[model samples]
Target chain A: AQTVTQSQPEMSVQEAETVTLSCTYDTSESDYYLFWYKQPPSRQMILVIRQEAYKQQNATENRFSVNFQKAAKSFSLKISDSQLGDAAMYFCAYIGNSGYALNFGKGTSLLVTP
Target chain B: EAGVAQSPRYKIIEKRQSVAFWCNPISGHATLYWYQQILGQGPKLLIQFQNNGVVDDSQLPKDRFSAERLKGVDSTLKIQPAKLEDSAVYLCASSPLPVPVYEQYFGPGTRLTVT
Candidate 1:
């Protein structure tokens, strides 16, 4: 079984600053995918960014990027120039080619200060 | 493109009662998923369907929880004789088949409160 872990339970960052949320996972498979999702108060889960385990290069989506270290089984998300809208519950997820469902970690609540 | 849709944004029921939630996935999506999200925790997979066929439901509590994705489009999750511990948000997600990228789109969850 694959499990994702988000060590931080809550994080606060000032506006215009950057914050990095840490995530680690345990998986036996060599091929897998990692994802970060944001769930706002509206209860909608939105995709932030994703990284493929085979890719050596990190995945970047504008202000959201991931520092993926496959050897360490660590995938951290970096939000650059944080804004108030970044306040939400962020989840780290893992899915391997052997399964169709995504295994999610306990979320880390982020509070963006203005 | 329309995202996944879930009905009954909120539901309240007493223990031993029955409740059901609905979900409509994005058009042309070949896979649908149901998840249970407890308060202050991440969403846990309850079931997965590949075009009306069950793919993985190992985590589903079959004794009380049941789900169906008829016609491979709309889905429904039902809990019979609900328990207080079942209080949580039910989320629905969908993705296309041959998911090389495995990007899933989610819907606003249906919050269920079992008193």
Candidate 2:
């Protein structure tokens, strides 16, 4: 079984400040994918960013980027110029590239203070 | 272009009662999933299906929870003799067949409360 871990249970960041959420995984399979999902108060799981395990370059979407260290099995999410709307529960997930269901980490709640 | 749809946004029932939830995936999505999210925890996959055929159901509580996807499209999940522990948000998701690169689209979950 695969497991994803998010070290920070909760984090607070001032609006316009940058924040990074840490995530690590344990897996023997070399081929896998990583994702970060955001769930707001409405409880809808929304995709924030995704990273391919084979890609050396980090994946970025607008202000969202991933620091994916494949050798170390660490994938962290960085939110730049954080806004109050970014405040939500974030989860890191893993899936085998070949075929497998996603394994999710215990989420980290992010609070953006004005 | 539509997202996954789920019914019964909220449900409240007494312990040992029976309840059911429904889900409708995107038009062409062949893979559908059901997940459970407890308070302050990550979503856990309860069951996964590929075109009406179950691909995985390792974590689902077979004793009380049952699910079916008759036409490889819309699906339903049921829990009989509900327990207090069954109180959680049930999420439905769907993705295209095969590739892991395909993102799974989720629906606003159904909140089940067993009192």
Candidate 3:
């Protein structure tokens, strides 16, 4: 079994500032994947970013990036130049080689303030 | 392209009653998923389908929950004799089949309130 963990329950960042959300996971599989998903008040889960365990280079999507430490089983998301729209509940997820389903952490509620 | 679609954005029902939610995945998506998202928690996979076949349903509570994806396109999830703990958001997602690990596109979830 695999599990994802997000220790922080809530996070806040000023507009235009940066914020990082922490995530960790436990997996026995040598191959796997990690992801960050955002759910706003709209109740839609939007893909923020993704990373493959085989890739050594971290994955980044525009203002959203991840610091993936495979050895430490950590995959943290970094948001640069945060905007109010970035306010949402962020989730960290994992999937083994099958990639059939995702195991998600509780989530981190992020607030962006002006 | 159109995203995944789910109907009845919100639902309220008394405990022990039955309710069903509908979903239509993006055209051509071969894998469909049903997830449960409780307040203050991330979405948890309840079941998954590869085309019209059940691929994974290990976490689903079979006694009161049931789901099906017919014709490999649209899907439906149902809960019978709902419990208060069943009050949560039901999300539908879809992705292409096989390698490359395509990102799953999500639909606006249907929120269920079992009172």
Candidate 4:
């Protein structure tokens, strides 16, 4: 079974600053997908970013980017120019090419302050 | 486009009772998923459906939990004789069929409190 680990339980950042959340996973399959999901107080899980194991180039979206090091099984999310709205629970997830079910980490609570 | 929809944003029930949660996926989406999110933890996939047919339910406690997706659209999850430990948020997510780059969209979860 695949497992995702987010060592940090809580993280805080000031507005306009950059914060990085750490994530690592254990998987035998070489082809898989990694994702970062943000769940705000509304309880809606929104996709923040995604990284494909086959692609070495990291994925970036607006203020969100990921440092995906497949060789080390490390996939970290970096939030640039963090806004107050970025405060939420961030989850690291893994899904292999052969399955649709996502394996998730415990989560990291992010707090953004002005 | 409208994202996934889930009913009864909050529910409260005593132990030994039964409860059901409903979910409506995005239009034209071929995949639907149900997840259980315990407090302070990430959402855990309970079941996945591909057009009214189940694809995975390995982690689901079939002894007391059941779910079904009918007509390849709406889905329901039921917990019989709920346990105190069952208190958690039920999340619904949907996505198009597997492609090169497809993402799963989630709904506002239904928070269930079993007292």
TM-score of chain A for the candidates in order shown: 0.98, 0.97, 0.97, 0.98
Lowest lDDT sum, 10 consecutive residues, model 2 chain B, at B95-104
Once model 2 is optimally superposed onto the true structure by TM-score, how far is the C-alpha of residue B18 displaced, in angstroms? Answer: 0.7
The alpha-carbon deviation from the true structure for residue B104 of candidate 2, after best TM-score superposition, in angstroms, is: 0.1
Ordering by DockQ:
2, 1, 3, 4
Candidate 1 clashing pairs, residues 3+ apart or interchain? none
Q: Residue by residue across B7-110, what tens digits does model 3's lDDT show?
A: 98999999999999999999999989999999888888899999999988999999999999888899999999899999999999999873238888899999
Model 1 chain A worst lDDT window (10 residues) = A94-103
Scored against the true structure, residue A69 in model 3 reaches a CA lDDT of 98
- Candidate 3, A59-113: lDDT as tens digits: 9999999999999999999999999999999999999996678889999999999
Give each model's whole-structure lDDT.
Answer: 0.92, 0.93, 0.93, 0.92
Span of 10 residues, lowest total lDDT, candidate 4 chain B? B95-104
Each prediction's TM-score versus the true structure: 0.97, 0.97, 0.97, 0.97
* Candidate 2 vs candidate 4, lDDT winner: 2
Best candidate according to DockQ: 2
lDDT (Cα, tens digit) per residue for candidate 1, span A1-114: 899999999999999999999999999999988999999997689999988888899999999999999989999999999999999999999989777778899999999998
Q: Name model 4 segments beyond 4 Å from true.
A: B98-100
TM-score of chain A of 1: 0.98
Model 4 TM-score, 2 decimals: 0.97
Candidate 4, residue B105: lDDT: 90
Listed models, DockQ each: 0.71, 0.74, 0.68, 0.68
